[model samples]
Target: MSSLLVTGGAGFIGSNFVRHVLATTDHNVTVLDAITYAGNAASLDGLPEDRFRLVVGSVCDADLVNDLVADHDVTVHFAAESHNDNSLNDPSPFIQTNLVGTYELLQAVRRHDKRYHHISTDEVYSDLELDDPAKFTENTPYNPSSPYSSTKAGSDLLVRAWVRSFGVQATISNCSNNYGPYQHVEKFIPRQITGLIDGVRPKLYGAGENVRDWIHVDDHNSAVLRIIDDGVIGETYLIGADGEMNNKSVIELILELMDQPTDAYDHVNDRPGHDMRYAIDATRLRTELGWTPTYRDFRSGLAATIDWYRANEDWWRPMKAATEAKYAKTGQ
Candidate 1:
């Protein structure tokens, strides 16, 4: 099996991907993350050293990226600044990691023999008409609204160019919101769960009407393995959970799982330019890769997630405390 190097393997999705790779397969895995406040090193706590190694480094470091590329056969890029709330205030980190970091890393890959896989978000398709209802496809128009998504969209374009111009064997996966265990507490799902668990009323932004399709991290990881092993080169795959829900409904579901009433939340002003809805047509992924979500409904997956948070307070309390410090420093 070829060696796999996963960037940002300490963060939420990246860390879950690493865990999936280590637990399910015998392939050698290497994780390179800068260990930002959001990137907690403990995510990869107990994997065998023979099967996994974690390197603390930024993706922007060209030498480091090249060294890892030289060592690994496939590179999955997931190291972008992901929080929408933080991206609004200072978009520089997002620009640096998403745009500049991608440029540097792709340049390195162009000099080597490897496949580069980029994990991107659904926010790239922002200009969807309020009334015009069409799920975003791989060929969806690039109309990103916020800084975080704009940079992610930019990085995806750069990957396209590298494949077109540099002959890099590359593929991209644009996915919907993901909720699962060990996710940083800043995201909506984990934030709501952790806050409610802590006996605090969770805050909802702008009446919580924004619609999103959410996929479990494990299902997302399963689709990723399919993309790496079987997806066509120079193609983009949309991996969705076949689930659609609004923000308010998601909160209510979490409340239900936690056995709390629906009135447990406090509404707050919506962030500027918040997209009202986002949905993706993942039929191509299903058709081309023969991939479908194992958990077609949110009930069991979310119930398990809530149970994990409930059972693992030791794991989440420190994370919640660390996020509070980061938020304080950034005034988020």
Candidate 2:
């Protein structure tokens, strides 16, 4: 069995991945997390202590990274400053974590000759027009629109360069929007879900026409495991489940499911540089790696997510007030 180091393992997607690995494989996992506002230690609670350990630290720490890299057989790099709104307010942290942090991870993996996989987002390809039928593929050109996306794009390029020049055994995957349990309230889905829980109107941005290709966090993690096992090095895969929905429709569905009025939500000013749409084409990953997403029904997945938030008030209550307060300043 492989020993794995998972950076950002306490955050939303990372924590889900860690659980997936433990449940499905015999790999012993080491989680390296900075416990940023988005990183919740409680997410890792009840995990098997003998096979799982959480290291509280930044990915930008080269010495720490090197030490960890030497012990693990593989490194799954997931640490990043990932919120678009936060990046717009201040780009410095995104630059440090997404760019510099990735560089340090690359160097450490290169030093140890360990296999590596880089987790990234579809935002790196920028956005598509609402009427456009095209979706992001492995060959999409880079055209990031926000500081957050730009830094992620930069990190992807860094991995590519390391694979070619330094011969670092690495692969990259750019996934579409993810929604599931343990997500921070700052994200779109969880933000709206929690707002409704607090008796606040769910807020929509612009005309609420922006589209996102939704994928369950479990599906994304499953694909990551497939790649780790069988995917060729130096290749890029796009992970998606073909679940696409517009903002307004999603809010309406949530309200309907929650037994609130369909029009119970509010329209707020959209964030600056908000992308119009993001869709992913995962044909390559499917045909090559034989990976298929289990959560295909968007409404079912979303309903389950809402139920999770409804039942787990204590897990998200501490961050609710501050997240809403930050959004209040911008009237979003």
Candidate 3:
């Protein structure tokens, strides 16, 4: 079995990707996560012990990364400061983790000559508006607005640098907004669902007009697998399910799914410089790698995800109650 190192495997997309790797392939997946608030061990609870291992560590630790890379066949970097609001409050940690952390991992992988993959978001592409939504392709310019995007953009640059200077075997996938189960409550979809379940009206930012291209976590996991298994090294791929929706639209959709009364949301101040719109063109990935999503449609996916949270109140209730406590502590 090919050994794979997945950073942040305890987080939303990373965790889903890890389980996908386990179910689909015999690959021995090693997860290195900091177990931060966003990273939950429950995400990997179903993983078979023999096929999986967890390392409580940071990608910023070069020595630890080097040791892990030396033992693994493939390394996928997914750890990062992902929340847009958190990045805006102060981007320092984002830079430390998104840029410096990625740099350390690159150094480690270069030393071991191992295959590497970087997981990135579509926010790396600047605002894409107008009638024909400009789908970000492999050649799109980096125009990150938020500190979170800036940090991710910086990390993507480092990936390119390592490929050019060190000849590192690496590939990067820039994807759209991911939604599904096991996601942190801070995220849009789950935050809304769980909040509604807790007898609270969820807050919506701005006019909620910001548009996003949505991809279910499962589809994103499959796309990453295709990239790692068959993707050409030193290349970057843009993977997105063609489902694009605006901020207000998705909130309305979620509220509808939950059978909540209309007008159940409170309007919050729009985030500073909130991206107006984002969409991706997956032509290259689909044409070259023959990679596509099994659940590109969000209707059933969102329904199932809501159902999961509804059925597993034991999984989300504590987090829902602790929400105010943590924010009060963080002063957010």
Candidate 4:
């Protein structure tokens, strides 16, 4: 069986991807995570121990990354300082983790001549105007607005350069916003969902007009696997399920699904440098690689997500107080 090393495999999307890979394939997996506040080891519970292991370390640790890369047949990089608000608070960590950590991985994989895949966000393309009829494609130019997205954009460029300069076997996938089980409560969807569960009024940023193209975490991971199996080296793919909804609508849906009045939410100050809208065009991934998202209906997908947060309170409860307090300080 092929051995895959997953960086940030304990975090939200990374944990979900790790689970997806284990459930669907016979490959052996090693998770390298920093165990930061956003990374929860419990998310990885119940996996087959024989085929899975967790290594606690920073991806920026060159020695650790090199050793791990040398041993694994493939490296799927999902590690990064991904919270936009946290990046706004301090861009230093984002730079250190996203850019420098990616550099370390690229160098290691280059040395080992192993296959690699980079997980990125569609925010690297900045945002489209709310009224614009355009969606971000693989060809979209890098114009990231926030420190979080800027660092991811930088990381993506690093992979491309490594592929050209050193011929590293790496491909990148830029996915839209992901929501499902194991997501930290600090995120938008889970924040609202858990708040309603706690009888706290859900907070909406500004008038909540900012649009985000959502995708189920599983769908995103499935596409990632498809790319790792068949994608051309040095190529980039955009992943989306065409699940675009404004922040206002998303909050309303969460309230509705949670048996609360849709108008029971409160409006809050919007974060600085908030992108107006983000949409992804996944034509290349679908037509070229023959991959399509399973979660076609956003409403049903969101309802299921709400159900997850409700049923798995232990997974998200500890972080709820701290996360809400952080947002309250900034009134977001």
Lowest-sum lDDT 10-residue window in model 3: 323-332
TM-score of each: 0.96, 0.99, 0.96, 0.99
Question: Tens digit of lDDT per residue, candidate 4, span 1-332?
Answer: 89999999999999999999999999999999999999999999998999999999999999999999999999999999999989989999999999999999999999999999999999999999999999998888999999999999999999999999999999999999999999999999998888888889988889999999999999999999999999999999999999999999999888888888899988888889999999998999999999999999999999999889989999999999998888778767
Candidate achieving the largest lDDT: 2
The C-alpha local distance difference test score for the whole of candidate 1 amounts to 0.88
**Candidate 4: RMSD over Cα atoms?**
0.7
Task: Look at candidate 2 and tell me the lDDT of residue 8.
Answer: 97
How well is each residue in 1-332 modelled by candidate 3, as lDDT tens digits? 79999999999999999988888888999999999888888778877998899999999998898899899999999999999878877889898889989999999999989999999988988787746646889999998998999889999999999999999999999999998888888788998888888777777787888888888999999999999989999999999989888878788888888888767787877777888888989999999999888886788889989988888877666666676665445433
Candidate 1 regions exceeding 4 Å error are: 127-132, 322-332
Tens-digit lDDT track for model 1 on 1-332? 77999999998999999999888887898999999978888778888898899999999999999999888988999899988878998999999999988888798778886888999999998845546678899888899999999999999999999999989999999999998888888888888898888887777788787888889999999999899999999999998987778889989988888889987787777788999888889999999899999888898999988888888787678868777676557433
The window of 10 residues in a row where model 4 has the poorest summed lDDT is 323-332
Candidate-wise lDDT, in order:
0.88, 0.95, 0.88, 0.94
